[model samples]
Target chain A: MEKTVIDAHNISKIYNPETIPVYAVNNVHLHLLEGEFTALVGPSGSGKTTLLNLIGGLDKPNEGNIYINGTDITKLSAGKLIDFRLHNIGFVFQSFNLIPVLTAKENAEFIMLLQGIKKSEREKRLQQLFKEIGLEDKTDIRPSQLSGGQQQRVAVARALASRPHFILADEPTANLDSVSASNLLDLMEKLNREENMTFLFSTHDQRVIERARRVITLVDGRIASDSAAVPTSIPHEQVVT
Target chain B: MILLMAWRNIWRNKARSIVIMLSVAIGLFAGIGVLALYKGMMKSRIRAVIDSEAGHLQIHHPDFKKDNHPAFILPDANALLKKVQSFPAVKMAVPRTLAQGMLVTTTGSAGVQINGVVPALEYSASQLKRKIIAGEGFHEGKKNEIVIGKKLADKMKLKLGAKLVLTFTDTADNLVSSAFRVAGIYQSGNAPFDELNVYVSLTTLNEWLLTGNSFHQIAVILKNDDDLQVMQDQLKKTYPSLLVQSWKDLSPETELMVKTVDEYSYIIMIIILVALAFGILNTMLMSILERTKEIGMMVALGTAKAKVFLLVLMETVFLTIAGTPIGFLAAYIVIGYYQKHGLDLSGMGKDMMASFGFETTIYPSFPSEKLVMILAMVICTALLSCLLPALKALRLQPVEALRR
Candidate 1:
């Protein structure tokens, strides 16, 4: 009964459409309600990342539409779409894409700065997020100075800074060791439960999939399965390969 | 924050940035130093011509310039000289009798332009008194005394105190001749001028020619050369029937040289700036290429394309702003030192410079206004150099760039 935060209707993306056409995302219909922690899982080249990109307005879909909080972002101009993404959606890349020149606090506060958030409010939110991510003492450290796990924690803090409707993380745990991966998932789950923060991840890691409340499996640019899962009941050996 | 990112990014590749900055500085230094030296040479040439030959302004009977005939003479020449010297801007004025004649000696004979001058007035009006390299200057009450150039003396084989005869037509169109003793030998450092000119006392020339105090030309020097045009205009108004001319009119070649040096400086500046622009472009492009992922990530996080373009531009501006002042300061120190102790071109181009009426020692000078102009040009070059790289940053697609 929670309000639907994302509504995607029959969207398709075709790559190399002029010659030897490849359909990267084909006629996918999906929706997520508020507070849903969802995972899009598929093997390599199965269109998991493509679907996430289309939903986040990072890539354009060739047909149909994607709606975030009932706004059709597929109809927006490139410039407007960037602004929309800034205010409405957060993104975490697999490579822990923090601007290497900026300190952790500056990186976290960057989106809010783009959104023209006042400095005092940005400071308040940045401080709270850093403490929540256990990186309070690492605020002045640049990405290069931080460990991989600490860097990813700062990336998560950046994503949460603007308090967007949802965050789309693409293979967020791909570069982390098991302990770092576990810690990141735990942090994300904690933010999801306590803050009702909606998240949609394109991941093949079993650790991530087991933590998601909803799992949508993709095969050959189409949804092969959509199911609900109990986090503790999902088997570790059943990770998408 | 964007500025901070741009500033920090320049230092990320310290060695590369420093190399580019140094290239810009060196190019600018070379361009400015060469321009200053050329300007100094032109200035020195102009000063030499104005001081030794043409005064700041000249007044002549309209018909006298048409031919060397002695009939065309300024009426009341003494009154005109006194009136010209009364002006506050007029530092000195002197009247001269000019004749194109032949100098004859026992050993040789050659053509010459005879200038009749009063010793004290001529000394104040021209630097000829200072240029006497051998023998003393004219003596008071000495009749038929002459000052001739060393080159002329050498050609005629006449030494100081040697007797020579000058032959020319008088005002009545009757041929006349006079004997004079060379009392002084001068070397004006100008080969052509020194080769064909001699001076005699105005009183002696007047007595011999029976021209009775009439003058062919009146030369006036100003306390400040900037008043040349104003004084020329005033003289023209005062003597409407007389032909009044400034140094620019009397010596068109020196004026042309000034303009040509200005134009050549601009051309050289453009060439240097173009070279510097290439260096800036290469550095900026490399910086942008290496930060492709970072730029992509910024755009994906909702930084506007304009912001990305500005970021690259800011980095380029910072590099130029840091380098330009250093270049200008270094040039200032070098040119200042040379301006105090002249840069000697005697070993390099003494004959060439002397032929062109320039001194062997040049004082390099840079005008403050020109310094401002060069700084503005450097900043403009930086802006122009950043365009292509900034456009490249604008063309980046967040999706594709992130993948790269």
Candidate 2:
């Protein structure tokens, strides 16, 4: 039994609570062990993003608690929760939100810089991540100068720079073409296998679901199914070519 | 890294940033330039009054200022003048016999103030000779020679060498009339002063008044104007019976002008700063609004709310810092040029300025102290302008901001 990295217990988030209430995330209980590549998949407006936000401590749940590495993050203050997220969790947005003014290397090193990592160590890790993402020559290029695929690669590198306990990616490949999407998934899979890095993604793309080892389906603000798949047995017909 | 990002972010919207900077620079220049002009005018007026009408300090018989009667005269005037001249700070002291009288010529008669001055001593103390516009100044052997203002001469329809009659009361309270010839006509650039004052030799006026050697007033000029208050204090302490006054005390209107000009400059500065603050606020707010998502992303990545506030503040400060010095430099150059050549308002306000004893041309001057004050004011304006936008940045929630 691997150590549990995330333990969420009956968390609920209600939007517009008083007038015409909507349950964005309703009483969801979930947990993930270390080194697992999990995917939260559902149709549009099914609360996948809301559940991910709760688990990452970006938003507070109205009821119940979320624990990351046995720490009850739901009880932390806004400031402390931010600090906790900085050291314990990484996030990748769907829009590839890289700071436009910074170069790729600066973007990748930004998280470590915030964490007070030493200058030499930040530079070394940034170089290794850029090389691993096949963006060694693009270190000095700003986000505007890079292609969409290259920008997403830089975003991924930034997420991995701090070596967090788990990474949460929200529709990470939504904006990418098939070729770029396939390359990104392959890179993430390689990182997961070699480094035993844990990742949780909220995605509707079948390509992402196929690569994920564990799939949790959400429907109408509740978890509808939870199952594990054999990595080699994914149907190629369902993957977007 | 935050500072670098702020700097780069300003250039992201190059046109907008430049517009804001130009507005600030132009506003500051206009405010400072107008203040310099007003200050220059006040300074010129004060200098004219001090050098021509009132010396650095003056002493008079305590009763003489209440009434112009000849009996109210300073006793031992010559000895007092000698003693005052001996002081190191006192450059020169000239005794004058003053009388309120009437001047009569062939065409008309007009009221005037008679100033009896010794030519040789008055030349060193008052520079009256340099101001003579028509006819030669007083000659060494000349008697009953008078120097009348051009306005007075024009009013009386009198010319140089023309005989004029002065009528006044003697020390015995009897009316006496004396005849004198106008030796020179002087124009002091002050219409009111030029229209009412006439000068003659003290020897002639003393004989006519039958007052012997007594004088009504003693005007003292100092080597350095900074020694005015000290010398006035010493003079008052020495001659407790007499009244000693500095130029500012004698001319309250000019002093008021000096004080009010400073106050008005600050008011104008505040108004201009308020206008600049609005421009800065608008630009900063727009910049923050456009980068809402980016700011959210930074906060989500663990940048503190305080750091986000600082980032916006730094952007405003950078914008102000870049433009303020340029405004100051431009104002300095303009004021410097006018200080050399003067800004000619003669064509516009010749009569108005002349009545107030100010020259037609004003030389603009800006002191180093005022520059420091203006810079401080600009910094304060920049900080004030950043508050609203910085607060807006601080209020952003990472979850909602990212969604936007």
Instruction: Give the runs in model 1 whose Cα sits over 4 Å from its true position.
Output: A228-241, B105-110, B151-163
Provide the TM-score for each candidate, comma-separated: 0.93, 0.91
Q: How would you encode candidate 2's per-residue C-alpha lDDT over A126-188 as one tens digit per residue?
A: 889998899999999999999888999999999999899989999999999999999999989
> Local error of candidate 2 at A209, Å?
1.3
- Give the top-scoring candidate (DockQ): 1
State candidate 2's TM-score. Answer: 0.91
Per-residue lDDT over B214-304 for candidate 1, one digit per residue giving the tens place of the 0 to 100 score: 7888888899988988888898998999999888998998899899998899789889998989989999999999989889989998898
Whole-model Cα lDDT per candidate? 0.87, 0.87
Query: B1-55, model 2: which lDDT tens digit per residue?
Result: 8898899999999999998888888988888898889889887877777777888
Model 2's CAPRI class is medium
lDDT of 1 at B279: 89
| Regions of model 2 farther than 4 Å from truth | A228-241, B66-72, B104-111, B151-164, B234-242
Fraction of true contacts reproduced, model 1? 0.79
lDDT of 1 at B204: 82
Best by TM-score: 1
Q: State fnat for each of the candidate structures.
A: 0.79, 0.53
Least well predicted 10-residue stretch by lDDT in candidate 1 chain B: B349-358
